[model samples]
Target chain A: GESVGLHLPTLSVQEGDNSIINCAYSNSASDYFIWYKQESGKGPQFIIDIRSNMDKRQGQRVTVLLNKTVKHLSLQIAATQPGDSAVYFCAENKGGSQGNLIFGKGTKLSVKP
Target chain B: DVKVTQSSRYLVKRTGEKVFLECVQDMDHENMFWYRQDPGLGLRLIYFSYDVKMKEKGDIPEGYSVSREKKERFSLILESASTNQTSMYLCASSLGGSRADTQYFGPGTRLTVL
Candidate 1:
């Protein structure tokens, strides 16, 4: 069975520091990956995404790195703030046009001021 | 922005009772999905519909069914709710396309079956 997993269940960082959340997926055929942020009592929101062909993609203050060979994915947040505290999940598109996502166990990120 | 809304923010039901969770999307997307989130399980897909009157079983579909009578609405039905069904249910929608399609999720419904 294909599965996605995170290396750390929780991560804490001080404000103004950089944070990195790592994820590993077992499905080699998965070509699309996305990072989502879920705050307390809210639905998960899309943060950034990357295709298998791309090694990395940059957003406003976040970046997603994809290492296809190792089936590893990471999200990097620069200058973490208290507002950045949330549960981060990495998902993979398994069936292409089917549009179903396989989500990894979330990594709870806490940014203390 | 894409807007997805669920019928309830929280619900409580007894065992053996029937339950329905409704979801609506204003984006006119072709794909709608129902997922349940647990403490350590993250999000697990229960069911999904790609078009009206069309549906498919996801990774976890036992004891659950879905209805897609209209394009904008998707409903999840529990024939007989149980305490094991208590969890946060999330509804999401996305455009129909390749794997790159981004899904937009609604505020989840927390159901407690006692």
Candidate 2:
């Protein structure tokens, strides 16, 4: 079965430290990947995205790395804050069309202040 | 800014009842989707519409149906709501074409089937 999964269910980090959340996807044909953050009681918000042709993409305080050889993806957050605590998910555009995405079982990130 | 709005934030319905979940987008996007987010199941797509009056069944569309009478509005219908259907239903919209286009999500509606 084609699926997207996470390395860990939860990640705990101290405030001001860096956070790394990992995801493993099974589909090599998946070319586009996206990272999203969802706070409690809120929908998932887009964090960043990367394409298969690129190895890394950086955002304001976040970075996404895609390793197609290992079918792995990672999201890195710098100087983690309490407000950054949320459930993060990684998705791949492998659902047959560009509008559909296959999502991972989210990683809960808890930042301790 | 793309804004996707659902009809309710919390909804309670009885088993054997037909339920309707409405989603509206203001950006006039051509693509609209319905997804259910569960604890360990992740986000499963129920249905998606690419154009007016056109829809496609997604990964988990067994217990649901969809309607796309217009471009901005997409509706999800549950013929008989089941307790297992209790989950957070999220609606999202994105610009047509390209896998890199971002999908903007709504606040989500938590549905409880009693």
Candidate 3:
């Protein structure tokens, strides 16, 4: 089945370090991708997004990279803080419909202060 | 900001009981979605409503039904809840067209089926 998934289930990073989360999507038809951050006891919050036409997009402290050739995506966070510790998810628009998205399992990122 | 609100933060229901989960979005989005989040499985779409009184089954719609009487309100119904139905329920809304891919989610409802 065509789906999106993460390469790592958990990650540990030191404060002030840069962290990168990886995702692999199998659907070739997916054009738009997004990253989300979900803290404990809260819902998922939009992080950043990248379109198939672009290779990278930057956020306040985050960056999303898309590789359409390898169908890979990554989120990079600079100066990782304790508040940056959360489960990160990557999503792809559902089969070009643009009305729905298929989310990946997730990667738990822990910042060690 | 897009505000999506669920009816409950936590709910407990017995097996075989009918359960109702309500979601309201103030953004006047034309698209609403219901999803179940479980360990390992991630967020599986249960159903979605594109317009008032219009619905489309998602990837996983069995044992779940939905109603969208109004544009802003969407409801998910569990005909007969079972232990397997225990999971976190998430509701989201989107602009419903070219921009619908960007969705705003609610806090979520943690439902436990006993």
Cα RMSD over interface residues, candidate 2? 3.9
List the candidate 2 regions with Cα displacement exceeding 4 Å: A1-8, B98-100
| True contacts reproduced, candidate 1 | 0.60
| TM-score of each candidate structure, all chains considered together | 0.94, 0.93, 0.94
lDDT over C-alpha atoms for residue A81 of model 3: 99
Residue-level lDDT tens digits of model 1 in B2-112: 999999999999999999999999998999999999886789999999999999998899999999999999999999999999999999999976555788999999999
lDDT of 2 by residue, A18-71 (tens): 999999886899888889999999999999998888999999999998889899
Model 3 is docked with a DockQ of 0.50
Identify the CAPRI category of the predicted complex in candidate 2.
Answer: acceptable
**Pairs of colliding residues, candidate 2:** none
TM-score of chain B of 1: 0.98
Which of 1 and 2 is the better model by TM-score? 1
Write down the lDDT that model 1 would get.
0.91
Worst 10 residues of 3 chain B by lDDT: B94-103
User: If the candidates were sorted by their DockQ against the true structure, best first, what order would they fall in?
Assistant: 1, 3, 2
lDDT of 3 by residue, A1-113 (tens): 11235343888999999999999986898888989999987889988888788999998989898888888999999999999998999989876464789898888899999
CA deviation > 4 Å runs, candidate 3: A1-8, B98-100
**How many residue pairs clash per model?**
0, 0, 0
